[model samples]
Target: MRKTALYPGTFDPITNGHFDIIERALRLFDEVIIAVAISQDKKPMFSLDERIEMTKEAVKSLSNVTVVGFDNLTVELAKAHNASIIIRGLRAVSDFEYELQLGYLNNSLDDTIETVYLMPKLQNAFVSSSIVRNLLKFNGKTDHILPKEVQKIIGNMTSCTLH
Candidate 1:
């Protein structure tokens, strides 16, 4: 049987750090599904459809990866997708506390589903979607934090909005 993993996130504007995790997960699992979750409490910069499209474009080069959107709990989505593992990216110590809590919650909800953490590559250690979004909001250069394609799209969006 092919090993499948689900990497769930808001991916509001998928960053290079996210790409790092996806690439690593692809190596560890036969298939890695990039699942975008819609959070009710958070106001995302990009809509769900937009996020999905961006994620798809970002991962287009990875043949073993797939992207999808989910409105339900991540554990539930994992079950539905027949995924036995949940892939998460760890950028810093602060992320551990939150991911630890999530792991416990996910295990409680579904014992069969396991959470795995992938550390971002050194170059992308500081790249985060939140940071990229903030930079874009201020007309800051995003080339350092995101792929060129993503930076171009964000630049275009900001330019059109300012016009």
Candidate 2:
């Protein structure tokens, strides 16, 4: 049976660092689903549809990868998609505390669902969706920081408004 992993995140504006994790996850799993979360609480700069489109474009070159939007439990989403593993990205020691808490929570909710953490490349180690959004929001330069397709989408936007 194919081993599918669900990589869940807001992916508000998928960055190169995010791509790094997806590429690495592909090495360990037969399939990797970029599960975009419907995080209404986070009030993302981009709408869910926009985020999904950007994610699809950013990962278009990849095989055995898919993107979808969900507003539910991560484990439930995994079960629905037949994903036995959950993929998370750890960029620094600061990320460990949060990721560890999440792993415990997900484990408590469903121990069968395994969570695996991957680190981004050294250059992308510090890049994150929030940072990317902030950079664009303040009209800061972000050359090569985001995927080309995502950068185009952000550039085409009349305003990368924050809420």
Candidate 1 residue lDDT tens string, 45-143: 877887888888888888888899999999889999899999989999999999999999999999999999999988988888888778767878888
Per residue, candidate 2 scores C-alpha lDDT tens digits across 49-143 of 99999999999999999999999999999999999999999999999999999999999999999999999999999899899888877888776
Worst 10 residues of 2 by lDDT: 154-163
Q: What's the CA error at residue 28 for candidate 2, in Å?
A: 1.0
The residue ranges of model 2 lying beyond 4 angstroms of the native Cα positions read 159-163
lDDT of each: 0.86, 0.93
lDDT of 1 at 50: 73
Per-residue lDDT value at 72 in model 1: 91
In model 1, the Cα lDDT at residue 59 comes to: 84
Q: Candidate 2: what lDDT? A: 0.93
The predictions' CA RMSDs to the true structure, in order, are: 1.9, 1.2
